[model samples]
Target: MLKEFQSLRLVETDFGNDVKTNPEVVANIYSSLLAKFDHNSDGVISLEEYMTETKKMMKDIANDIGFMPIQMVLEKDSLLMKAVELHHSASAAHTIDC
Candidate 1:
């Protein structure tokens, strides 16, 4: 995936691929991308790290949102939905116990 990501020919510039045609800037960009994606610094992106970063980004977006209700669509069987169900069930049980 990293190889594929690095192979993109997306950079278009007035000077034409800058710093000497298809140049060092691409490598620099990929290095920065790797640093961001490879959170564990193991030089690779694992599923866990990706998900952790994703959840942090979602929380950031949620925090940026104010007052307005944000609608999120999730499959009923998704783990997040299941977590919501479990919390509701536990709250109901706690009310009964009280």
Candidate 2:
């Protein structure tokens, strides 16, 4: 999760200040994302909701950091795909060991 966030250049700039490095700030960002993505006011976000919310948040962050929002969106997509790939590989390895 931290790696994904770090890949976002704008996030590193705007929120990258010392204050943003605090654990509390990181937790707040995750909590807010979860809350916003849970559209039905439900405690959980479906996969679709999570994707939609993530894109929106990325765009907002990009704009806030004075970068091209589209670039951020693309970067997010790349990061997500990488995460999925890693997860699948890890799961496959675990299954093989078992």
Candidate 3:
């Protein structure tokens, strides 16, 4: 991955700046990101594989970049709350039907 990063010329670019500026750090981050989306037990990531693993990939990336805590607080909580509410409503409807 470090080789890829160096070959891809991520030096001083927007991606390099936003993420780790150091080439080694960027390489590590890139490797981890690729592993996150590498489904089908393969080392490569295809579009279909990536789409299938979207949620897990995003969560893994967030966790890797130390954004998981903020994400859970800001997004996961709301999504889980909505899911719980929907489940409760569905349960109530089922009870009424019965």
Q: Write the per-residue lDDT of candidate 1 for residues 1-98, one digit (tens) a residue.
A: 55666666455554453444555777777777778878879987899888877666655554444345776775887656555566568768999999
The TM-score values for the models, in the order shown, are 0.44, 0.33, 0.37
Worst 10 residues of 1 by lDDT: 58-67
What order do candidates take by TM-score, descending? 1, 3, 2
lDDT of 2 by residue, 1-98 (tens): 33344445333545645534666666667666556767887676778888887776654554444433443234545745455455568768999999
User: Which lDDT values do the candidates have, in the order given?
Assistant: 0.66, 0.59, 0.60
What candidate 2 gets wrong by more than 4 Å, as runs, is 1-33, 67-98
Report the number of the highest-TM-score candidate. Answer: 1
Model 3 TM-score is 0.37
Residue 3 shift from truth in candidate 2, angstroms:
20
> Backbone clashes in each candidate structure, one number apiece?
0, 0, 0
> Which candidate number has the best lDDT?
1
Deviation (Å) of 81 in candidate 1? 10
